[model samples]
Target: MTSAALSVNIWSIPTTTAGTTRFTSKNGHTLDYRIHSGIVGNRWVKDQEAYIVRVGESIYKISWTEPTGTDVSLIVNLGDKLFHGTIFFPRWIMNNPEKTICFQNDHIPLMNSYRDAGPAYPTEVIDEFATITFIRDCGADNDEVINCPASELPADFPANL
Candidate 1:
C-alpha cells in the first residue's frame, strides 16, 4: 500500500505569556496552542514517534516526527553532542481515514509558582520556560489540552539543542 503524503507548519512563540495561538488551514481545520502554564521541557523525539511521561500529577503522551522536504540538518549536526538521552521515533500503521497532521517546534516556557514569603522579600520566580517541540495527530476539530506537572519530566529526556 502507498503511504500518505505529509505537510508541515513552522512558527515561533515570541514570549512566555498565557494565551492561545491559532493557525487556520485551508482544509477547514484550525491548529492551536493554549499556554495555560508557561512551564515547558527540553525533550526531543524522532519523527512519528511518541513517548509517555508523567508531569506533576498528570501523564501525557508526547511524540514528534519529521516531515518530507524539511531541513533537519541543524538537528543532525548536533546529534553526537552528548545529550541526556535519545528518544526513537516509532513506526505506525493506521487503517483510518487520511488527514493532515500539524507539527510545532517551540520552547515550552515553565513558571515557578511555589515560593516562600519573607519580610520585604519578593517571591521566587522563573521567567523562562523549557523548550518542548510537539506534534499533533489531529487537526482543529479536537480541543483537548493534555496537562502535566512541570516537575514530572523523564530522567533522561533527550535534549533538543
Candidate 2:
C-alpha cells in the first residue's frame, strides 16, 4: 500500500530549522507559520499605499493611518503565518493563500468588490486618514520601498495582536 502523499505548498520550502516550528490546532491538526523580515525600510511614495496583513485572526485585517505618513514597512511571522506591509503580500493574497510565503493570512475577508458587474468594483470606505499618512509621495525623490532588508520594519508590534 502507498502511504498518503505529504501535502506541500509555498511555505513548504525554507521550512528547515528557520520556521519549521509547528502549532497544534484545537482539532489536533498541525499548524505553523513563516514570519520573516525585520528592519525599518522606507515610507510609501503614494497616498494610502501602505498595506498590512495578519494571520491566525478572525478579523484578518486591521488598519490605521495618519496624514503625516507611516514611513515604514515590514514582514514578520507570528505562529503559522507571515505579516507584512509590502506590495508582494497583497498580490499573494489575491492569487492563492496556500501559495503565500507562509500561508499565515489564509483567512482574509472575502469581499465582493463589484456591484453592477462593470469593469470596476465599488470601493469600501476606510477610516478618516490622509492618503499621505499611510503613503505620502510617489516620485523619484522617494525611495523605491522594495528593499527587503531596507524595507519599513517596525520596532515591535503589540504582542497577541
Candidate 3:
C-alpha cells in the first residue's frame, strides 16, 4: 500500500465561533472539540483542536494545533475489547517531524497473542507508537515506506507537511 494509505478521512471543519471546530467523518461520526487559546509557560499557546471518533468500542482521539506543526497525533482507547480496563494507548504520530509519514493498521491481532482471530486489518494495534518513515523518490512514481533506525530523511520529502 502507499504511505498515505488512510482508510478514514481527516476532515477539518471550520469553527462557527473562535475556539471550536467540529469534525465529521463519512461514517456519520461527529466530534465536537474545544480550542484552548492562551499562553502556557514561556511560549504562547494557540488553539487546541481535538476530535473523538468511535469505531466499535474503540474511541480514537486525534488532536493537534498550529504550534504542534503539521504532525497530527492520535490516541485510541480500547474499551472492553482486549483488556478489561479502559486502556488508552498511543497509536501513531502522523507526519512526524513534518516530513516523516507513518501509517498504522488498528485491526490486527497482537504480535504475541495466543488466540487466533480473523484476518488482520490495517487498524489493528500491532505495535503501539510504531512508525515508518516514508521517502519520496522523484525518479520513482511511488513512495517508499522504511522501518529502520532514526536517520536523516531524504531531501526530496516534503517539509512541514
Candidate 4:
C-alpha cells in the first residue's frame, strides 16, 4: 500500500491547520503541541518517536494535533488494549474533546492527511470531490508539503473509510 508516486496535484490544494497534538511515550513522558508527525516508510518521520511507535509492540504514540496542526497520528496495538489513544486522556481533551474538530472548504488550505482517525468536519457528507475534504489519514514524503493526498487516493476522501 506504500507508494511515493503521487496521483493528484496536492499543491493545487491549500493548507489547513488543526489544533495542538499531545504525544506520550511508553515511559510516561508527555509532549504537547507535537507540531509534526509522519510515517517512516511512506513519509519522513520527523519525530523520532514515530519510528519507535511504528515498530515496538510495548510502545505506542497517540498524537491528536488536529487542533494546532493538520495531521493526527495514532498508533494502537489492539492486542495490548493499553489505556491509549481514546482513553489516554491528555490535559487538553479532559474537558470536552467532542468540541474538537477541523474544517476544510474553499477558503482554508487542506495540506496533510493522516493514517487513520475519525471523519473530517462536515455539515452533511457529500459524495462529490468538488471541495477539499481532508482525509482520515494524511501525509507526504516531502517535509515542505504537509499532506500529499498520496496521489493514488480517491477524491471522495473516505467518508465511510
> For each predicted model, how many residue pairs clash, with residues at least 3 apart or on different chains?
15, 15, 9, 20
- Reference-based TM-score, model 2: 0.17
> Candidate 2's residue-wise lDDT over 28-84, tens digit each?
121212234211112111222223333333112323332222122323333334433
Ordered by lDDT, highest first, the candidates read: 4, 3, 2, 1
Q: What's the TM-score of every candidate structure?
A: 0.19, 0.17, 0.21, 0.21
Give the per-residue lDDT of model 4 (tens digit) for 52-124: 2333533343443332133344443423433222222233332323322222222123212221232333212
List residue ranges in candidate 2 displaced over 4 A.
1-96, 102-132, 141-143, 149-152, 156-161
State the C-alpha lDDT per candidate: 0.22, 0.23, 0.25, 0.27
- Badly placed stretches (over 4 Å) of model 4 are 1-52, 67-75, 86-161
* Runs off by more than 4 Å, candidate 1: 1-31, 38-132, 145-161
* lDDT for position 149 in model 4: 22
> What lDDT is obtained when candidate 3 is compared to the true structure?
0.25
Which lDDT tens digits does candidate 1 get at residues 1-161? 11111122222222343212211111222223222222223222112222223222222212232321111111111112111212221112011101112122321111011111111122122232223233323432333332222234345521331
Q: Pick the candidate with the highest lDDT.
A: 4
* Model 2 residue 135 lDDT score: 15
For model 3, how does the per-residue alpha-carbon lDDT over 1-161 read when each residue is reduced to its tens digit? 11121233222222222211112222222222222211111111112234434444344445442222222444433332121111111222111222111111121233113112312222222222311122222221111222121123344422432
Residue-level error in angstroms, candidate 3, position 49 = 1.5
